[model samples]
Target: MENLTFEQLPQAMRLLHEKLDRLEQRFEEQNTLQDAETIFNVTQAAAFLHLSVATLYVKTSRREVPFNKQGKRLYFYKAELDEWVRKGRKKTMSEIREEAGQHVLSTKRRT
Candidate 1:
């Protein structure tokens, strides 16, 4: 323990820092790849959407959900599922009426 001189300490610390940096870089790269992945199988998709497996299958049968098929296997993308959920949001009647009123105003202005 007492054999380590002052100059040796800095060199050892630098080596440790370089190794730590490489480890951190590898971790970040792995995390990025995981985050970028979007594919999910039927069970994963159902769990993500909080729907029953039967209901998910029904939607697939109706071609109402976004997915990819490889032979008999189906895959869903997390991003597409997110968008599908957003598209299913129902507009309030008041909001629809407001859009209709705007359409009428635009028509009058054109004429």
Candidate 2:
């Protein structure tokens, strides 16, 4: 390694820091792509979601679950399945109360 002059040390450190940041960003992107691209068959999907195979099939049949169909095959993306579960999340009591308060305030202002 070359001895860095005092004046050049900060510039060198800045450049190294930028390179490390770029490397970290690329690593994160690759990991996200890997997770988002994960595909599961019906059996795997059922296991992943902790549901019975029969129940998974029922949801797919009724189009209640997010899925992909190609010919006679069904496919599920791990990301999509995660999102589906998140979408079904229920509000907490605090959240409902806050919403009710907002509604009451708005209604009072209307009159």
Candidate 2 lDDT by residue in tens digits, 1-111 = 899999999999999999999999999999889989999999999999999999999999999999999999999999999999999999999999999999999999999
Q: Who wins the lDDT comparison?
A: 2
**Tens digit per residue, CA lDDT, model 1, 17-64:** 999999999999987667447699999999999999899999999999
Model 1: how far residue 62 lies from native, Å: 1.3
**Model 1, residue pairs in steric clash:** none
Cα error of candidate 2 at position 1, Å: 3.1
The lDDT of each candidate is 0.91, 0.97
Off by over 4 Å in 1: 1-36
| Model 2, residue pairs in steric clash | none
